[model samples]
Target: MDMSSISRHEFRLEFLVTSLLFTAFCGYGLVWIEELVISEHWPLDEQRFWPGKSYDLNGYLDIIVAGKEHPQYGRPNILSLRYLDEVARINQYIVHNITVPVDLEGKHYEVAYTDLCMSFDWACYLNDHLTMLMPKSRWGNFSGPIAEFASDIINNEVNITYPIGWRGSEPIYFGALVGRPHLVDREGHFDHATALRLTYNVGNISYIWRKKLASWLTNKEKPPSGESQMLSETAAGEGQAHCCLV
Candidate 1:
């Protein structure tokens, strides 16, 4: 081959190789970024932790009432009458401020309290859910923190002061359950029983059942009152029973 042709061929080969390497590096970097985000925001364990039911307002109310009645499961002061009152006010505010689109059937349904709380600017849903699921022993003096959090939420404050141990930035849906020592021991060892309790009792089974009940209630054209009693009983049972585990 001519000298110029040989030189051109060499340059083309080098260019192709460099482009492939750049593309591969970019692909790897993207994958790593996605993994990091998922681990911090939605851990694999939490993604697997589906409650298998939709959350409705009544079911959440049932859970709140049950928590108030049985304070041993969570922070005693946070589950008091005052807390219930605040929650009711917040619910009203949400109903008025937020406009949820109606279904095709033209039946207007209020947003589920749980759904609203979860979507709220603050981490109210995570705080309440963890407070109820985690034993009171694990929670140390959350009364003051939770009270302030609730008040801020009620006042529609933009800058929220999150409770200790709860993530304010990059909120994780159920990342707390996995990060806490409840699933792992002091030496960073995994506890099988604790894991089972979290998976079956708190996350998988009980949570799923409550969600299902909530879904059923919201889906109904005219939900009956009898199910509320059953839901309340189930919530009470879950609070009392699940708290005793691990």
Candidate 2:
């Protein structure tokens, strides 16, 4: 073979292999890191963590509700709970601002009393999902980030919650759960992408790890501000679609 032809073929082969590895790397990152923060289980663990940062959370929360932030709605203040009884205090702080009648109609709901303090990532998820799910409601389809988290936690296969359809299909249908106080929505998935955020939990943010974990994380939320169903479940009946299409 001519040198030019051989070089061209080698470069193509190299590019293809590199792309594959890059893709895998991204996927790993997404599963291990991004999903945890934005998907199903991070907040659950956080809820538990917040209560136990000191001697406070010992009996109140032995299993879940760690690190959960009871941030005041509308206002930037966070009540910061250490016990379940604090729910009353938390309610007084930011509960009123939460959608009172609990409707997801044309009106723009407040940023959510608890949601007011969404990390940058959480904020992006809300905007993207709200625009994606609610607009689709016009076409008889609905989905969003909160919906994604709820599904991840309660989907039948995972069985985080009892009874197949206990949590409804999408987050909007169950927005009240966020305000319910006793709801236990939690799951632990540390495959690769979820492991990305998990890596932070475990402490590893190198480029290589981030690259592999990125793919898993990307599934956590869409790029934000698009009108696609994101997943392929039929509207209304499918409830919440769980996991990735891949």
Candidate 3:
């Protein structure tokens, strides 16, 4: 080969080698960090490490509720949950303000309340579903810091009670069951790009494990038919649910 051609070839080869080295180094670092977190930091046994029913969970989502700040009909605060593969079960909680009225009956009356906007990320699963825990509280009132609400969400304590309007009915207290989907209205609002980036940035190591587990789960089974039906129903219940598409 001519001298100039040889030099160009050498430069290309060097560049290729440098790129490969950088990539490998990054990959190795990711793996090492993951190992450290799982083993030394938040270590658990193999069985406890990945709990919950196995599913592919290609990020199907359900709504929990919408809280409005003004307690008005048109405005809504959004709260939602989604299965982001097997590694992360995400909670997106939005708050709103509301007011409900009940007429005084001779014998019975109803108590109504409205939602008040907050941000939260409740933790439902740990180490890609190894262990699950509930947050201490669900939706926080608008008076607190958003980060506190987010911390509560990650801890899995997101049970919110919103008053749409006052109706004369018996009072019932309740809590959410773990592994159960939220009772969402028909519409949903989310920033997919933002959530995805947040997931990776917050749990980049878990993402690596999630991809592998998700592949295995997908091969093992399919999403439940009942769940599919429920999701479809939500889509159909848009107007009744008072939701806006996002």
Residues 1-246, model 2: lDDT tens digits = 699988888789789999999999999998777656643433433223321122211112000111222355321111122222232322232223322222357665433323322123332112121122121223233268666655554334222121121324432221211122223444321111110000011011122222222332233465111211123222211112111111
Per-residue lDDT for 169 in model 3?
38
Residue by residue across 1-246, what tens digits does model 3's lDDT show?
Answer: 699988878789789999999999999999988777656643433223222121212221223222222335442222223323211232221111112233455554332111111112322331211122112242333445887666755444422222121112321122221222233543221111111111111121223223332232223243221121111223311111211122
Question: Model 3 — which ten-residue stretch has the worst lDDT?
Answer: 193-202
TM-score of 1: 0.25
After TM-score superposition, what is the CA distance of residue 7 in candidate 2 from its true location, in Å? 1.0
User: Residue 63, candidate 3: how far off, in angstroms?
Assistant: 6.4
Instruction: Judge candidate 1 against the unseen true structure and give its global Cα lDDT, from 0 to 1.
Output: 0.36
Cα lDDT of candidate 3 equals 0.29
* TM-score rank order: 1, 3, 2
CA lDDT, every prediction?
A: 0.36, 0.28, 0.29
lDDT of 1 by residue, 64-115 (tens): 2222224454423332344434434333433334333334476765443333
The best candidate in terms of TM-score: 1
Clashing pairs in 1: 51-208
TM-score, prediction 3: 0.24
RMSD after CA superposition, every candidate: 18.7, 22.0, 19.8
